[model samples]
Target: MLVLAIFVGAGAFIWPQLHGYAVTGAAYGARVACSCRFVGGRALGDCRKDFEPGMDLITLTEDTAARSVTARFPLIARQTATYRDGWGCVLETWRN
Candidate 1:
């Protein structure tokens, strides 16, 4: 019971920061992977090589038909970016 309370307390404090970082990481991963896959003409699986070392928690998925990539950080955050002819890769607008 005491351990559970402590865990809850810690989680309440840490969750917001963790969620914020996850959001940023997901957005960055989506944009980078989109560009790598669509603009660089690389396979989606191969785009992980382009991410920074600490981004392992982010997972990327490609929409070949839409020319976009979506990235997720476990249950915390998700974001998408699409490739355009003139704009390169553009992140989708965030919604509340």
Candidate 2:
């Protein structure tokens, strides 16, 4: 059907934008939570309050040994932030 085709085309174009927003939001939440926990000397449980808007739907994971934190935006994207001794939090980029 023409309407179905049109709807599919619109969704194909819009999905990337929506995914990008999710990725950005998750990355931001991860970075802030990482900084708050590692550099700011806060508890991981307490860092939930620092998440960016819309990040409530994301799932966060922290690796203490790796000094990193990751945020997963379900069906959208995942991002990680690493904490260094001198630096606060560094966001990791996707590789080609």
Q: How high is the CA lDDT of each candidate model?
A: 0.92, 0.85
TM-score of each: 0.93, 0.84
lDDT of 2 by residue, 1-94 (tens): 9999999999999997888888888888889889988898888879989875556788889999998999888888888999987877999985
How many steric clashes does model 2 contain? Answer: 0
Worst 10 residues of 1 by lDDT: 87-96
Best by TM-score: 1
lDDT comparing candidate 1 with the true structure = 0.92
Per-residue lDDT tens digits for candidate 1, residues 1-96, read 999999999999999899889999999999999999999999999999999999989998888899999999998899999998899999999642
Clashes of each: 0, 0
Which residue segments of model 2 deviate by more than 4 Å? 1-6
